[model samples]
Target: MVWKIYMHMTSMLCLGVAAFFFGGLSLVSMSTGKCSLIEWELSSLNSLTVVFVLIFDWISMLFLSFVLLISSSVLYYSGSYMKGDKNFNRFMYLVLLFVFSMGMVILSPNLISILLGWDGLGLVSYALVIFYQNEKSANAGMLTVLSNRVGDVAILLSIGLMMSLGSWNFIFYLQDMVDEKWLLVKFLVMVSAMTKSAQIPFSAWLPAAMAAPTPVSALVHSSTLVTAGVYLMIRFSSALEGSKIQSMLLIISCLTMFMAGLGANFEYDLKKIIALSTLSQLGVMLSILSLGYPDLSFMHLLSHALFKALLFMCAGVVIHSVKGYQDIRYMGCLVEFMPLTVAYMTLSNLSLCGFPFLAGFYSKDTILEVAFMSMINFMSLILYIMATGLTVMYTMRLIFYSLSGNCNLTTLSNIADEDKIMSDSMSLLGLGAVFMGSVLSWLLFPECYMICMSMFMKNMVLMISFLGALIGYMLNMLSVSSKLSSLLYYKEVVMFGSMWFMPFLSTKNISEAYLVWGATNEVLNDKGWFEHLGSQGLYYTFSKIFMILSSLQMNSIKVFMKTFVVMLVVILLFFS
Candidate 1:
């Protein structure tokens, strides 16, 4: 308990530090309207040199502030959520370390030093994901770490490729190296970002990482861990412009958004739904980054973090009150049990769908509008619009099943919002979800982006939301629409309904195969072939050589005496 309070206080102090930076950056943006970076040369003793830089630009400050804010709230929430765990102190330590890593990723302009923080995050997050000590958590932790390891390795390769420049500080060299000659380096960096951000094939791990505690999901998944990739791409935007990889990333990111949104619709697990919601939002951020609007991407990144964190906290509350049944199908009319939580959930989901005047409304709406205005190919345009619509589809599905439907819960005796620790943390995040977007838009953009497009393009998000609401409503009346499930294409539904077979790929295909290979090598090589060929072979060969040497040594005394006597007799005869 002392540790919990200490962590809460520490996190609050972090929030204060972030608040100070936020104010200073906003004031500086107003005055100078330029980036001010403080770079201290860390190593100049050798041929290799690197700078430790903390960029105090609006983007850095704003993003860092949001990360810290979410960190603070998550630590506070963990005090309640993890109070019963035996290793709660270790949990607090890991969470603080995770936050510190996120801070490193946020403040560093040099990719070399940023890799330190990046790798730290992956290691600590793996520990956190597997903290539950269950088989599911174990698999999830392995997937989470392995997926992120790809990025870590990619960064290392990028650093190696960057050695020609004599420094790994990308901010200093990337602008000059934007030509075709540095394409491999740029591609490595982009691939690293994709792995970190959970794009496409690398995306299977994000939802699986929900095996972590809710606080980890709220802090890491919704904001810090997943956003690191997008944040990196945002900084590397100058070098990445007009690259062929950007086009590929655009397609991959759109697929992630569409697939995650569709998976959320088919999902019944409450935490996983929110987890998939986060994946979709990540795709949105990645999409905008690929479109080369880091400002808007950063904007949506901040706002999405605010509400998505709140959404997870709300899910945590519901799960806690209802005694750990995560399936939304088993949950209904939670509003009757916890009104405050339901309200938070509603606002966050609406914000997720880009509902008017909320945090998600500003950045998400602008992203869609910008995409529509761009001369993208037909498939890209359709996917963008449908992904936006699917946001509403999943949000409504979650709302209808979990919040407003019948009170399907069997045991309702213990359900209540009595935990002040959780309530306090969630209430703060809910406030941010409600107001952060407008404030960020006004501060960051100052001037809104004006685009001329058709009404279909402008209203596409809303139209989809409207239609999704009707479908979601009808579906919630389960008896009336039971046949709709049958009417759906079973094979297609099962394919996407299983999250594009991601669970199978991550848990069964990929991870299980590695486990099998590891076991095979251990049995065949370590205990079998290598034992005989390496350790046992050497033992037997050396033993035989020693035995022969010992026999010769024992005989040497007799043989030498006989030889000496014979030589003496022969010498006497010769002398005579």
Candidate 2:
């Protein structure tokens, strides 16, 4: 019956609408401070008390609005994109599940609720990633789920640690914890946030996540899942107000920014490049949030959602038109065939690159200025500079590769314009990217900027970063024999060598050798030690051991059965 109901369009639409209304009402009630209609108070649960205030923040309301809007857009777009697919009903169900889960995540008032939402989103995303049921998709889904689980465990630890410190409520605990204890909590939170946000070591999973459909990628990268990390940071920024955690966060953010930027430079896949660029921009926002400017972070988050969605959607259009080729290296001279798409893509990329007057410029400039003003340590300054430089490098590379590079005539011949639905969606998102900055001007700059200088002086560090990007772009375009071309081919090698190999080398030989042996044995031995441990089959061995020790219990069962049979026979004989 449930499956039958889900198969119908009307039913799916109703479910989506219901979820939207419920989420909206939750936000509205929180804003108005009314008793929630969906309330389920758990006074017995001490941890519930810690996160209660999370339900009522104005920022949460704003996040809910975006969640509903983007989710609705994806649903609308999917209706057409997925019209005749065999698994249309299944796809719709997953979409509904995704939206519902994100709604819960955004509206969750406590840690337990947040974890529930987080797990739900992660599960739905994994399912969606493997929707096609292909080998590559399945592998991608597994990687995504594993990485998310790692982050989820870290979050659980952070919550547990906070609770152990005698403060479970975020507001109370954050407000009441001693400086030292709070710092420790902040560290745990940062680790969790890093994994969720795909910073540095965890960043590789995001590119792999591009295995999902374009719409899923847009939803994940642009609006919801990735932003959860930033949301966490913003929600707890007050607690992290005056700690070294902020400085450490800034450094992590910068490293992610630099690595993603450099990685994107060598990427040829249009979608993968966009994914890396998303990571890079997210790093910028995290850095700003680290500087204790939630407003700036919020502004960038909004602008990034608009423009990055537009950019990804445009890439989707190109891929759809070309029958699934996403390599920008082979795609060229699309301006003639896809003039409107080119226009939209160009505008969105401009916003991404922080060109003047676009949404990105205002938000990014604000962050740069804040970082400059709030420099508490040398690490912060270095991080700020590196972040700025990387931002410029990758954003420009995305623009050049997609819109300006030399066209491969053969690839161009095979390509055509996308469907009207795809084009229209991209155009709409592009327009949003163009206009969102001016819509929220107050959040962009502090009043001090207006008073201190007659003209807004963009940070010199940012300027230098921009110059570095321009130079990199020029070098890429003008080099007759490409030095960077080889570097691009081996970019993954660099990333793996730096992020994985170096760390592996730093570990003690025993640990490193164990890892090496496990990798080899995992394939060589179908039932390897690590595999057995991973499966928790140690319990099975213990069960066998228990069976041997408790052989008397087995005899007891036989005796009891025999005694019951004898008693039944005696009763029968007496009756006879």
Q: For this target, which candidate reaches the highest lDDT against the unseen true structure? A: 1
lDDT of 2: 0.70
**What tens digits encode model 1's per-residue C-alpha lDDT throughout 1-576?**
686677666776777577667767756776687877877887684687777777777677767777877888888788888888888889888988998898889888887889989999899999999999999999889888989999999999988888878877687776787798998888888888888888888888888889998888888877789899999988889887888878888899999999998888877889888888888888888887888888889889989998989989888988887778888877888788788889989999999888899999999889888888886888888888778777787788888888987677876447888899888888888989889889888888777688899887677778877987777676657733466764468888788877788767766776668889999999999999998999999999999999977866886888778778999999999999
Q: How close is candidate 2 to the true structure, as a TM-score?
A: 0.78
Can you give the TM-score per candidate against the true fold?
Answer: 0.88, 0.78
lDDT of each: 0.84, 0.70
- Whole-model lDDT, model 1: 0.84
Error of 1 at 470 (Å): 1.7
The prediction achieving the highest TM-score against the true structure is 1
Q: 367-479, model 2: which lDDT tens digit per residue?
A: 77667666447766675676566656666666665566776546335555546656655655676788878765653343534313223344475567668688768866764
